[model samples]
Structure formats: C-alpha cells, structure tokens
Target: MINNVRRDLNDLPQSLRNYLGVALGGAGLVFWVIAVRESHFLNMNAYGLVSILGWPFFVGLALVAAAFTVELFRAPLRSMQLTILIVLLVLFVFGTPCAVEPVASLTSSWVHAGFIQYIVQHGHALNGYDARFSWPGGFSMGAVLVAFAGQANAIGFLRWFPLFIELSYLAPLLVIARSSGVSRRAGWLGVALFYSTNWIYQDYFSPQALNYLFFLVIIAAVFACWQPKPLASYGPQSGFWRPRLHQNRNLLTRSRWEGLDTTSTWTSAATLWVLGLIGIIMLASSMSHQLTPYVLILALGACLLTRRLGRPEMVLMITVLAFGWLSLGASDYWVGHLNVIFGSAFQVSSTIGSNVTGRLLGGLSHVLIVETRILLTGGLFLLAGVGFLRRSADSRALEVLAGVPFLVLIAQSYGGEGLQRVVLFGLPFTGLLAASAIFPLRTGAIKAILPAFSFGRFARFAKPTVRMAAFVVVLGFALATTVVRGGNDSYESFSKGEFDAVNFAYNHVRPGQTIESVNGYLPVGFRGIGSVSVTTPAQRSSTSVRRVGLRLLRDRPSEIILSQSQQLFGEEVSGYPVGWEASLESTLVNHGYIITAQWRTATVLALTG
Candidate 1:
C-alpha cells in the first residue's frame, strides 16, 4: 500500500501537486473562517486559536506543510515562493477575516489607532498625551496615510494592520536567512520557523512594529552587502596574533585581531551609500521608537564583533543619532523623568519580578497559556543549541545575531515589555539557527533533505516518512504557537459594541469634563482631542480602585464610565478578582451617581446632586 502511494504520488505532475497544496490550504482557511464566524468570543478557550474548527484547520495545515516539504525537495527552485504563500496563509488568512472589530487579542491596537487619530485631527502631538507620542514619527506617518486615503479615522486600519506588517517582514527575513551562511534548505526552513514560532504580537500597528521593519531592513541590507563565507571557508586558519599585551594597544585594528577580509558585494563607494542609508533609517527609527534605535546600535555592534560588518564608525554614528533624538526630539518624555529612564538599568531581578512574575498572577487558564508560551520559546532555543552543536562551523552569524539582543535585557525594562521586545528583535535570527537543528547543512545531494530519525528495521523508509514527519512537526508548531500567541483574545480583545459605547461617551462629554474609569482598557480619547480630560489611574489594584473613584468625585468629573471589557481586563491582566466592578458600581451608586446611559458592554454614570 505504501509503495503504491509513493508511485501514485511520483506519477502526479508538479502542477497537480501545487494545485492540491493550495486547495488543501484554502480548505483549512475556510474551516477556520467558518469556525470563528459562527462562534462567539465568550466561548473561546484561554488561547483564542482553539475552537471546534481547529481540528480541520490543523489537518489543512498538515497538508499544506506536506506540500511545502515535498515541493521543496522535489522542485527546489520554485519552493520558496510557494512556501512564502503557505506562510502568509498560516500567519494571516486566519486573522484577516476578523480584522474589522478589535479582537480579544490586544487593547493597545485601539489605543495606537487613537494616537494616529489625534495626530491626524490636530496635526500635533498632545502635550503629555502619552510617552509613545513623545516619538510620534510612526503615529504621524499613520496620520499622513489616513489623511491621504480620506478616511474618517484610524480605527478601520487596526484589525488588518498586523497582517500587513507581518507579510512585509517576509522579504527582509528571507534575505537575512539566505545570506547568513546557512545553506539554501536551512534558509527556507529558517524563514518558515520564523513564522511558525512568532507568537509575539509586536506586529500590531505601533511604533515598535514600524521600527521593527526598519530594524530588519537595515540588518538585511548590511548582511547583503557582506554575505557570509561559504560553509567550506569556515575551516580553521593558522595566523599569528600580536603578543597578548599588545592586543589591547589597538582594539580598532581588525587585521591584527582577525584574518583577511572577504569580498563584499558592494564596492567601497556603495558601502558608504549603504552606511549613509542605514544612518538615515536609524535616525527615522530613533524619531519613531525609544527602544529600537538602541536595539539597532547593539545589533550593529554585534555584527562588527563577528567581523561580518567592516564599518566600525557606523556603530558610533548610530549611537550619536539615537542619543541625539532622545535629547532633542524626545526630550519631552525623559527630561524631568530621568529616573524612569535609568532606574531599571542593571536591576535585572527587580525588572523580572515586576515585568514577568507579576503578570503571571492570573487565572488557571491564563497561567496554562503563559506556561505553554514559555515552553514554546524555550524549545526553540534548545533546538538552536542542538543546531549549534551539530553544525558548529556555519553558525557564527546566527549565533552572534541571536545572542546580541540579550543586551537589551540588561539595559531597561521597557515598561515590563523588554523581554518581549528582545525576543521579537531576535526572532528572525534565532529562527534561522533553530532551522539549522532540523535541517543542518549536508555535504551532497542529501543536503536538500531535512533531519529526521528512524527506528530499528525501518531505517530504509526514513527518507519519505521523515519528510512527512518533519512537515507535521512544522505544522504542529505553527498551530500550537498560534493558539498560545492569540489565546488571550477572549479578554484582551474588544467588541464593536464596546467601541460604540466609548465613542458615544466621547461625543457627549464637553471639553475639560473628566472621564474616569477604574481601568483604561476601553477605546477612549481616540475621537476627542483636548475635548475632555480622561483619567484612569495607572495603578488599577483593588485597593486603588476606590481611591481613584473618590479622587474623580473630588475633581467633579462630568461622567464616570465603566465597561465589561474593563472588568475582564482587570480580572485577567490586572490581577483584580471577580466582582470588583460590581463593588465599584455599588460605591458609585451610594455617592449619588445616576446611570445616564447603558450599553450591553458599557455604562455611563453621571454625577447628580
């Protein structure tokens, strides 16, 4: 039966195989759409990826992955294009259909859109609007695009922006993977692993997302200008270095420290042009994001250390640009609050305790999802380690690239998201090394074949069976990581009704009227620029809730708004227990506040005499 299946498979035309692959992938997408469309958000598991439709989706992914592996091995030339399409299908097709209203995935998406709305309407960043606005390049760019498109506001773009940003990453990532010294097969698998394991939601429409693209593009360009040596050239060389005491005499001398330089694709003049282009990108990134510039600087330093980059002056130039932007353009954010900038530097324990350990306090389902996420990340690193051991000669580029981002971990907490940012910045490189684990560069025709194991008496069947198994592994990781990445959507995402309630409140509130909530999860301040004063105390602890309400009452706010989304957010991410919202409501009622308006998802309480 197996022999017959193989014969039948080999007899089919490549066109038929490609068509079958697309058909299977499309069927999976359809199943996912039907499942999400028919199901309600409340019914989602801890991870949003699982539903009655997930099984079919998994089967579909299996078929698609199988198609990718088969086509890659059989017809290596056109495999990348097909594989990229498959990647887009996996990363985007499931999510794009539901992009209109905010998903339970993130509240920041709405908040970011609000920033763009502010920029578009007023043509200026509001003073003390938020720290993100201090570097308003990305928001301003969004504003320009929105204005050019003649859109009413930036809200419509939020749902689909993640997909767009993720797809945009493919080209640069492929370039980086291909030229980073890995073989052709490793490069393809690396790119695929990147999409599969990228559960980080940094691809949302924000400064980080935009700056991350700049980061990738810059790295890709640099690596392109100086591609790594072929696998054979990585062998040892016998060179006499200067005496140990003289080594420190001139640290800038590359020839004395390392061997002869390899040929770069770009001439010295073109290299200068690339460096100038990189400087401009770094400047723009500096204006757009607070963290990515530093990330870029550190990554460039890593490239220099590996001898993959020749321009050492480029590093110092980027540093000046980043710090210059912080001093001049973003002075509003850190001028008086210098402590916030430097307080957590080197305070790794405190940073972790607050950023990581604190957020781990959640319900069982949330805990499970978080643990799964940790395991998934750790598993990737472990694979990279194995790949490092298995193929030591051809991994220096990936290793240095992957390891450099850890420098960010030591610098600052990025307001508890530092680790996440680090993982995201390193993902493209780490994914490359991780792929080397499954498909280490081989010497001959078998170089195309991915790594797979066989048991006793079945070794002869390993080639075909292992190919199918490898695809299965890839598909499984993609599906599981998708579930873990988006699992929090049940509580984190908002509904259109929720947005309507917030919009209605904004329209009704007059300028200077205080709009207060115990938590800032609702879509507020997106429409009304300087029209109202909205306050949600940064700390939303149960003890602080009453204090915030009393404080708002003291200030004589025009309206107090609360919503089901806020309540859920507090319970889930904020560590508030159940019934916290009701208690606050009871407190409001006792203070002579009347319910002026109510929606299924939100409520407005007006202060009465």
Candidate 2:
C-alpha cells in the first residue's frame, strides 16, 4: 500500500505537484489565522499557550511542514515554493505568540525598552542603574531607530520585534546553510529544522537578539568568504583509532598546513573589507551583549582549527575586544560582581546542574515542557552524530562548530541559560548535520574520515523512507516546538488588563515610591527608569498569605500591583496555592491597604491613611 502511494505521488506532474505544495501552504495559513482568532489569552491554563490553542494551530503547523517536505522531495526543487513554505512555517512557529498575545511578552523586553527610552530621552545610559546598561550598544542603536522613526518611545517596536528579528535572521541563515558544504536539499531542510526547533525565546527585543544576528552574520561571512583546501587522508582506513605521533606530525608540516589552509576567490581587498566589517560587528557585539562576543571567539577559533577560516587573526581580535570591553567599557558590571562573571568557571557539573537540573523544578506542565526541550536537544545531537558518521565532507568544520559551543558551558553558566544558548549557537550546523543523516552526499572534496555505514538492503527503499523520515522529523519538531516554545506563556505572556493595571500603578505612584508585586512577570519597567523602583519578593510555596501581607506592610511600598499573570506564575512555577494572590490581597485590605485601582485581570492596592 505504501509503495502504491509513493508511485502515485511520483506519477504526479510537476505543475500539479507545485500546485499541491502551494495549496498546502495556503491551507496552513488559513488554519493558522483561524487558530489565532480562536485563541484567548485569558483562557490559557497551566499548559501555557497550548492549553488555549485549539487543534487548528497544530493542523496548520502539520500542513506547513508537509508542504515543505513535499517540496523538499520534488525533482528539481522549487526554491521559491520552498521559501514561501518556510516563511509560513516560521510564522506558525514564531509569529503566533506575537499575533495571539495582547502586548509584547517577557519582562526583560520591557526593561530593554526602558533602557532604550532612557537613552533616547537623556542621550546617555543611566550609570550604575542596571548591569545590562553597561553594555549599551543595542539600546543605543534602538534609540537611534526610535529617533529615525520619530517615535516617542520604544514601545511601538516591542510587540512585533520578535517576528521581525526572526525573519531577518533567515537571510544569514540561508547563506550559512548553503555554504556549509551540504547538499542543497539538506541545506534547505536544515534551515527549516533550525526554525522549527528554535524554541529559545531569546528572540524577544533585547541585546542578545541583536547580538545573535551579529553572530550569524559573522559566521555566514566566514563561510561565504572561504573554502577548505583539499588535503590527503592520513587517518586509519577503518575503525576508531588515533593516528600515530609521526602521522600527526606529518599532517602538521608546513606543506600539509598550507594544504589545510582555506582559500577564497575574492580579491584581497574584498577579503580585508569583509574582515573589517566583521571586526566592527564584533566590536558592536562586544559592547552589546556580554556572552555573544566570547561565543564568536570560540566559533572563530573552531573555524580556524578546522581549516575553514583563512585568517587566524579574526579569533584573536574578538577575544581581545570581548575582554577589553569587559575591563574598560563594562567595568561597572564586572567590577564588583567578578564572582558573578567567573564564579562557575570550569565547574562543569555545577554549571550543568544549574543550567539543567535547577530548571526542572516546577509544575508538572512546566516540567514536561523542560523535559521536551531536553529531549529535543538530545534528539538533534543524536541525529547529528549519525550524520557525522555517514556524511562525506572536505573538512570536519561542521562537527567542530557544533561541538565547540559546549566549551562555553564550562566558562560561565549565563545564569542557567548557558545550555540553551549553546544549543542555539550550534543549531544551524547541528540542523545541517541532522539533515545530512537523511540526505548525505555520496562523496566530497576529501575522503571520508570514518568508513561510511552502508544501508545495504534498505537502499532499495531509501527514497520513500527518506521522505517519510523527513516528514516525520519536521512535523514532530514543529508540534513539539509549538508546545515547548510557548510553555511559559501562561505566566510570561501579558494581557491588556495586566498592562492597564501596571500603567495605572506607574502613573499614580511617585518618583521615589516603590511598587511591589508577587513576581516580575508583567510589563512593568518601560515607563519607570531610575526614579521609580519595583520589587518582587522571593517566591516560596511555604510562605503563607499572612506572611506575604506582613512583609508588604513592613516594606510599606506605596502601591502593589497584583495581576493574573503573576498569580499564575505563583501557582504554576512557585507551587503556591491557587488564588494565593487573592488571599494576600484580602489580607492586605484587612490591614490598611485599599483597592486603589482594579481591572478584570489585575489590581493595585495602596496604603490607607
């Protein structure tokens, strides 16, 4: 029966196949629109966006994945059709949250907006205000944009920034994928996989998002500018054994090293110009985000070691710039918090524990989401390993690039998000390698490093099996990503009511007065900079409502803003009892607090005279 279906599909005319692909993408878009219209943020539960998202969203995602897979398998692939399908898939995966939510999500996005606003208003970063402000290039750039657009603040740019930035990433990603020494089909599929599996929420409006763009552009430039020179095989013909010291020395001789060096067709002037641009981007990245510069250094070093980079000086330039900014420009951040900077260096176990184990403690739904993330990451790496064994390539550059990001895990944990960042930095290469498992080249510029595993009898059914595998893998990732990507939206995503309440508090509160909340999940910081302060007490499930009220009373904050998102966070993540916010609000009212303002999803309480 499967063979018959495959035969029928193969018999379809090229025009009909193209139409089918277009139809699938159109249907997927329609379903996605329906899903967005059907979704209600207020209805979201512990399962996060998935809880509120209906079947249409999943159907839409599946359709888009199917369309891409079908296009991927077609003879003489339709690049335009595949591009449209991938864009639709990206929309389904990344743009849904922006479309469904009332306002821009994530507290850090709002804070970053606040930083940009401060820069726009004052023309300088507020000193000693925020650790993030010490590296202010992104915020400064945003301020320039705001001025260029004649916008009063950065709020106008926040809501759809993720979608815009993600779409922007696709260009560099395409360059990287196409130039990464993979088959054209594998490169396109790898690009799709990169988007499908990118559940990391760092694309929100922040320095990291912009720096990530810089990261991609730098790597893409390197790949486009250089290709590895062909070298003779020196390793064992079979089995996993190390080469002898003499063979290794022979491999490293001046002639051999020259053979290993990368070559470029571009003129030296063009190469120097591109390198200078890359340097500027590195400088900007170093001043924009603390971590990406080091990641770039590591990536450049990986390229250099793997003979994919023509210029070795690029790595040193980034390293010096990254640390130089740390010592000079960002002194305010690391001056006193040196331990925070280097506290976890070489503490691999502790870093892993913090990055992985610490994140596992939450509600069942949250735990499931985290587990899915881990599984997705592990699954990609596992597939990449198979590809590495099966693939024929000129250089082991992809393998090195994919593996080198892990070294960042040993240096600093990046506040428990290091692992996620590592996964992201390596995702393009990892996706390519994983795709190679499905569509590996027969041969390349150099002999295979490892003996290629033969499919043997399975080779007869390879085409259909490869199609099915690609479809399953892409669709499975799309579905899983839909769940895990928005898994925190129950608390992380804000509603209009929450926004209104936060605005009310900010407007009514004085410059020196503090606004208190149970958590920092809402849109609170865009308006207030150095003058107004907001505080969220440490969340503890053991703490009673009475104790929370007592702490509020002791702190005597001028106003307290409690919202549905914060309450959901307490119940879902902190393990606090459901309606704990209400209980605490009642306790505060009974003492001396009055409900100064109220909204359907949020309330602001003020102390009564």
Candidate 3:
C-alpha cells in the first residue's frame, strides 16, 4: 500500500488520484461500519466514542480525510464524486449501521414520520394540528416522495433520515465553501470541520433538516451568482440605508447600480434564471420551516449589507414571502399564540438560560457531554475570531456570513430552542472561517506564523506534513462530535419491544381516545396521528413527578404509556429521580388503572372507571 501510494504520489495521474481518493474513502467507510457493528446501541455513551468504534474506524477516517486533502491540494479540479463520498461517509459512518429497527435515538423522528403519514393519507395538511404541521411543506414533500416510491408511510425513512439530510447538505455546502474565497484546501477542510463539530441534533427527520438544505442551496446560489467581480467593489451605504422623507433619488439609484456590465444578453438571462431559482427556493423554505426563513432573510440582509448580494429587493421579497405566509397561510399557528411568537423577541439571556442552562440536568457523563458541547462551540467562535485577525482570504464574505446568524437571536426564541438552531445555521460559515485559522490558504500567512521555516527547497516536503497535521486536528473534532452528538442514546434510544407495545395500544384504542405519556420521548403516534391523539400529562418544566402522577390519575386518560426512554426522558429533561416512572406506575395501579399489555421495554395501561 505504501509502495502504491508512493507510485501514485510520484506519477500523479489525475484519474488514478481520483480513483485512489474514492477507494481510500470507501475503505474508511468499511472500517467504520466494521468497528461500529461490534457494539450495541445500549452500551453507547460519550466515552464509547473513543472505545466502542475502536482504532480501526478512526484510522480509516484519518486515511479518508488525508486522501481527500491530498487530492484537493494536488488536482484542484471539479469533482462531485469525491465530495459525495466524503459526505456520505461523514454522515452515515455512525448513523447507517446504528439506525436499527424501533425508530429510536431521537423520539422526534417518529413524530415527523407521523406528520408525513398524515399528509400522505389525507389530501391536505391538518389545520390546527400543531405549529410544525402548520408549516407542512417538508412533510407534504415527504408524503409525495413516499407515495412516489410506493411506500405506505415514512416510518422506514426515519432511522437514516438524519444521515440522508446531512449528506444532501454537502453539495450546496461545497459550492458555498468553494466560492467563499478560501483556497481549495481550506474549502475541503472547512467542509470537514462543519461535519465534525456538528453536535446540534437538528438533522433528525424533521422540517428543519429539509429546510436547512433549501437554506444552503439558496445561499450557495447567491454566492455563485452575485460575487464581486475582480477589482469591482461597492459600498454598503447604498444598500444599508435611504433617506425616507427627503427625495434621495441619487442614493436609491446608486444602490441599484451594482457596478457590473449586464449588457450581454447571456449574462442578463442567466442572472434572471439564478434569481428566479433562488426565489422559488426561498418560497419553498418559507413554507417548509419557520425559523429558517427568518434566518435566511437575515442572512440575505447581511449579504446585502456587505454588498455581496446585488438585488436589495431580493431581501425585501424574501421578508414579504416569509411574513406573508405566516399571516395568511399559517394564521392558525399564531392567531391564539401571539405571545409565543413575540414573547422572546428581546429576551436573549432568558432564551439562552432556558435552552442551554435548563438542559444541564442529567447524569455526570451527560453533564460532561453538555460541557464539552459548550467548549466546542466556544472554541469554534474563538477560532473564527482568530481567522478574522489572520485574514487568510482576500474577501471578508465569510466573516460577514458568520456574524449574520447572531442577529437571528433578536428575532425570536423559536420556543426557547432558537439558540440551538442558531448554532446549526451558523456552523457552516463558522467552520469555514475556523478552517482558515488553522489551514490558511495563503502560503505567506503560514510563513508569517512559522517565521524560522525556510520557504525554498524544504517547502514541498513541509507542506504535506502540515496538511496531514491539519487532517489530524479535523479528525479529533469529528471524533469528539461522534461522542457527544448522540451521547444521550443510552436512555434516549428506544427498543423494538417499545414500538410493539405502542403499536398494540394504538391498535386497541379508538380514534379521539387520548393516550397519555409523561414525556414524548417514546416512539409512538407516528402511524396514528389522525386516528389517535397523544398528550404529555406532565409539564416539561415541572420537577415534581408526584404532581405529574396526580395529574394523570385525576385526568384518568383513556390509555397510558410507560417506556424505558420515557423514564430516562423524565429524569433527564425534568430532573426527575431515577425510577420516577415506576413510582408513578405504582400510583396508577393503586388508582384502578389495569395493565392491559406489557412488553420488555414498555407497558400500556387502561383506565378502568
């Protein structure tokens, strides 16, 4: 293998290098699957990120990253094949193998599948169903696709959907990174970093995941079409502000005067096509997800401010579409819940406290995982700051893009989960700038940092070693992410028996009969959204399990579910003590609720009046 690598390195055939690159990546993926196959989902933890996957997977990832880095630096050509493989391996290395039956890990994936199922069965979306169902563009799309694929429902898609959506993100991300004014090497590394440190779990089979792809594609289109031509620059004052009272024709006209000759019919037509495509994507995104359209609006606004986006009207159009859709199409969502929409508009600290600080209730290992997440996020921002200081690239596009997502905080709390979504939206840009901090595109920057190094004969030899070192650093982040990203899978993941128990209860219960759970972390209701109703009896913020148990008994829900995941969800989310579910179960038994069905991982009880 070493001899083959040396021969390839020496000869440097483009075809051979590309083939070798993919081969190495494929081998890495195989090694990763082999390593992960040995472990059970029950045994996984933050620590298992290192111990469970074994050395072979990490070694495989390292080889793959190294090969991609070498190919990118050496060839510097367009190749979707390599990028696609890298993205697949990055996303699915842990996910595809672990996406076993029972629809576990993330409880929300099942709910999303249910939403799709509802849409597929019925011709239209269920109005007043839920806030998420109101923005049912993604679910509708999923339903259409499922029907096209001859699938009855979206349940089969839930397990590997995160990996699928993440892999889908790679195409547009590469486009954004390449045009981000970073070198090819830095672009690839940035992509790696984006995947590596993505501990944010928004990639579940949800609207956000689908809408995020639209967001990336739209941004990539903007970057690809509206880049500042060589030596052509414009000021932000034109786009940023205008005199409303006074007749400022000059300012208005100047803002419209994006200094480029569009007399060429081809250029004009192509620009129109790109803008039209972006408009369509923006509309789709607006209809699909709530927070993302707002985020996209702000991101486009930032681009306008930075003069990267030419048509200032594009920003206005997007804003109108997003707000217009909310007002007319999704009126059911905000008509009664106006406070939920505008409550956290200005309460930034409160939002963070609720989303971040409130989630810290867990075991020692869980707490450590959360802390590590904080550190990783902070470290990325710090590196972004360093990138700003370093200025590895000629354009400040990435810097502006990185800063724009911060403004999303002031818009809404997104039900206290806004900050988490903020991290995810900012990650792609942050990863780019962060990569620049480490593997600078300009050789001159490297010389500046390592001043004693000779830039003459030894530079050739030194460059490969530096790239390898950068690869190792990126691998470290990936490994860390693999650990914390799904660290909660121990209690979070459901079993097949849990699914069977829920299915049995669903089969027995009639429509409109309420099925109550302490938490929604168990896999249920995905196949019976319209046929059955599910509710969580306990307030997520309430810490008293006894009070919750009393509420359940008093309400006398028609049916009840208690799953292992629900127990852990109670302990983790509400800070309930271990065996709180058991305590609640005992109370229910004493209250004349009889266990109608039981599975190894779950139980169903009926209220007998």
TM for every model, in the order presented, reads 0.87, 0.95, 0.86
lDDT of 1: 0.70
- The worst-scoring run of ten residues by lDDT in candidate 1 lies at 444-453
Give the best candidate by lDDT: 2
| lDDT digits (tens) for residues 200-260 of candidate 3 | 8888788888888988998887777776533233332332133211222322345534523
Kindly indicate the candidate among 1 and 3 with the higher TM-score.
Answer: 1
lDDT of 1 by residue, 166-225 (tens): 788878988897778776777777777788888877877688988999999998987888
* lDDT on C-alpha atoms for all candidate structures: 0.70, 0.86, 0.72
Measured by TM-score, the strongest candidate is 2
* Alpha-carbon runs more than 4 Å astray in model 1: 1-8, 11-15, 45-54, 80-84, 90-105, 229-253, 256-260, 267-273, 392-395, 442-458, 541-556, 573-583
Task: Write down the TM-score for model 3.
Answer: 0.86
lDDT of each residue in 102-144, candidate 2, tens digit only: 9999999998988998999899999898899999999999999
Identify the superior model by lDDT, candidate 1 or candidate 3.
3
Which ranges in model 3 have alpha carbons more than 4 Å from their true place?
A: 1-23, 44-56, 69-85, 92-104, 230-253, 256-266, 392-394, 442-465, 572-575
Q: lDDT value for candidate 3?
A: 0.72
Instruction: Tell me the lDDT of model 1 at 12.
Output: 86
> What local lDDT does model 1 show for residue 470?
56
